[model samples]
Target: MDEAIIAKGLYKRYKRVQALRGVTFKVPRGRVFGLLGPNGAGKSTTIKILVGLIKPDKGEALIFGKRAGSTGAKSLLGYAPERFSIGNNWRLIDFLVYVGRLHGLSERLAAERALYLLEWAGLGGYEEEKFGNLSAGMKKRFGLVQALISDPEILILDEPTEHLDAIGRLEVLNRIRELASRGKTILLSTHVLAEADYVVDSFAIMNRGRIIYHGSRLDVQGVVRIVVDKPAEFEKALHRAGLEYSISGNEFIVETSGVEDEKLVLRICLDNNIRVIRYDTSSSISDIFMRIVGAEKR
Candidate 1:
């Protein structure tokens, strides 16, 4: 895949806090990449730099090979932050029309586009509703409509699923995947692991302003259950391998660095005739996130 966005050693600092330090990741064209982390991680800070909302203290960020925040770069991207950043007083359609105009659209065309967006977002019946009166999910759809009004090549989303319930989250996730299928590149920053799991093509897991892991979902192991007749021998092997292994009953908990490590252990066990009774790996996105962020307890 071609690179649509890239960041190298990005650093951002506040008066008393270093929100981002040496953060780096890449987004390939026509794919939805998950920018995942727990609260207080640098997901938001990294996105702000990508969308031109804020500048980085050090290092570099680019959109389509150009410096981030330049008009040429910004024109290629649209963003909807975690917060409802649009005007609350306007009706839903009005807000869409207003944003369309801001993007240099004519009044008549903007109106037509607004109606189309409303229907597309499942809000056609609520066109006259005030933005402030809409439910959180509705507001999110409204925000998404405006971001796409510009018909940008790239989309920057910060916690897009933040205020959504189960159905709402699924809708958003589905929309993101649809966009990716249509060749739109996306930077999806979300705490909702299940949403990311269902939609994202790749992920970068961050923690305390640093990226701890980044790769395809297939590479990470979220859960492991190992069964062996001589548990002590397997436990010793795990220790010698310098892996983070836990225990529950006679079952061993193993988290591989990636598929490569998992293959290594499996090969060794099979060769040694270790009577493995059971072994399983979890693909749960939530479990992956917790382990990556060091938030999992045993």
Candidate 2:
């Protein structure tokens, strides 16, 4: 896959805290890549370095082969930070236009793109509203608009859906999906693993300044839960099949490597003549996230 962004052995330190420790990952072009982790896990720091807001003390960050923080890379990237950094006084349209101009767009082009983005972000009639006067959801939507004003190849969003209502979150997620469909490479940094699972093609989970998990969502190992009429027989069948499994009360929790493994478990129960009562799979990003990060804490 063509890489849209690459971080090689990235290391950063802030006084006593080591924000990043040899972190490295690649975001494939034209896909939604998630940087998922808990608070203070260096998601923001990694994003900051990629967007040129801050420099890494060691290693390198690159955007499409150009060093991150370089003018060429900056032009290809659009970033929306975790916090709202725009001034309160500017009108929504004006603010977006200003951001576009800063990205080297002409005044006429800036206005044109701002108008289109406002509509795209569902902020059409609210263009004249002051930035401070909008609702929390509206502000988040506006932040997204400003980020897209430059028509960048890559969009980096930091906690885009944080603190929003369910409806607002849905709106933002749908917009992200739309952008990805149009071939824009997206880097989504969020602590919300479930939400990230909804949109990401692949993700990297970070904990305490280090990456603990990195893989495509389809390849994520998850547990398959099965309840059969005969617990003893089911356990015996699983053992005979040579599959790693754990017994939980009457349910069998089978560790699955992929979709194929999950299907194989069902086949094993059938072959053993075990009547299946309930078959369910729990492959939530949060499940593995807790397992990995919790292990590191120990």
Candidate 3:
């Protein structure tokens, strides 16, 4: 696959605290890559380095084969920071237009693009409003508009849906999917794994400034939880069916090879005349995240 971004042995420090420790990852072109971790896991620091806001103390970050922060690389990148800020006094349209012009667009072209973006961001009617007066969701949308002013090839978003309501989160996530479908490479840095799972084709899980796991979403393992009326009979059924499972309280977490295995577990319970109270197939990204982090701590 063609790589759009590469970080190799990236290390950063602020006084005594190490923000990044030998961080490395490759983001393929035209894919939504998730940089996932809890707070202070170096997500923001890594993003800042990629966008040229700050330099790494060691190692390097590259964009499309060029050094990060180089003019060629910067021109292809757009960024929406975790904590977005804009001049409060500036009208929404004016702010977007100014940002567009700063990206080297002509005045007329900037105004045109700004208007188009305003409509796309659902802020067409709020153009005259001051940036400070806009709601949290509106500000996030405006930040996205500014990032897209130059039609960047890669969008690096930090906590894109941080404080939005349910509706607002859905809208932003849908927009991200649309961009990816249009062949835009996106690096979404977020702690919200459940939401990220919806759009990311691949992901890297970070912990305490180190990436502990990275893999395609399709390869993520699935577990099925089943609660039954007869625990002893269920265990016998599982062994007879040659299925691996573990019991916790009243629930059995069956290790499934795929959808067929999940179905087999249900069939086993039925064949043994066991009553199943709950059959849960949904697996959470948070569960995997916590398991990894918790194991590392021990």
Candidate 4:
């Protein structure tokens, strides 16, 4: 496969805190890859390293075939940080035009692209709006527009939908999907599992500065949902049987490989005299994510 981004054995430390511990992953060309984890999982640190804002204590990051942080690599990449830093007094169009010019675009072309992108991002008439005056969601939309001003091949977005409302989030997500469809290799970092599920082709789950799971969306495991009266006893039984599961209220989502595994779960319940209130074989991304993260905690 043609890899667009490669993070090989990357490590970083902030004084007493080890932010990233030998983290590694790869994103293929023209695909949407998700770097998923909760806040403080070192997702932001990894992104900073990739964007050349910080150097890793160990390992390396690569964009296409070029070393990450190198001019060659940076030229092909665009980034939107979790927190944006821009002049409060600058107008949206002017800021984007300046960024485009910095990327070597001519004055006229930069201005044209700035206007076009602002319109596409639903900030058309707001081009004259001051950066600080715009609402949080509008600022986020403009941040996205700034990232695309240079029309980069690879985009690294850190929580791109952070402050948007429901409708705004949907619009931004749809835009991301459209970008991937146009063959732009994107690396999206977010804590939202459903957001990743909506657009990412593959994902890596990070927790406590380590990568715990990495797989494609189609690699979703088979799971069975069971609700029983004796929840605590059933949990104990599950532990004795060495079966992995996650609890939410009266429900338990247990992983199963096949029919035999499903039968094993039922057998455990029967052996423990647990009264089954309901049972079904349905699962969701949130369930799977919680299960994986929960197992790591145990």
Query: Each candidate: what lDDT?
Result: 0.84, 0.89, 0.88, 0.88
Q: Select the stronger candidate by lDDT from 1 and 2.
A: 2
Model 4 clash pairs?
none
Question: Per-residue alpha-carbon lDDT of model 4 for 1-298, expressed as tens digits?
Answer: 4999999999999999999999999999998999998899999999999999999999999999899999998999999998875989998888988889889999899999999999999999998889999888888888888999999999999999887898888888998999999999999999988898789988899998998888776566458899999999998988888887888788898887666778999998888888899998755556668878988879
What TM-score would candidate 2 get against the native? 0.95
CA displacement after TM-score superposition, residue 17 of candidate 1 (Å): 0.9
The alpha-carbon root-mean-square deviation between model 3 and the true structure, to one decimal in Å, is: 2.7
lDDT of 3 by residue, 128-242 (tens): 8999998999999888888998899999999999999999999999988988999999999999988877898888999888899887775555578889999998998889888
TM-score of each: 0.84, 0.95, 0.87, 0.83
| Regions of candidate 2 where Cα sits further than 4 Å from its true position | none
Q: Model 3, poorest ten-residue lDDT window?
A: 214-223
* Model 1 residue 217 lDDT score: 75
Query: Per-residue lDDT for 53-147 in model 2, tens only?
Result: 99999999999999999999999998888776577889988888787888888999999889888998988988888888988998998889888
lDDT of 1 at 21: 88
What order do you get sorting by TM-score, best first? 2, 3, 1, 4
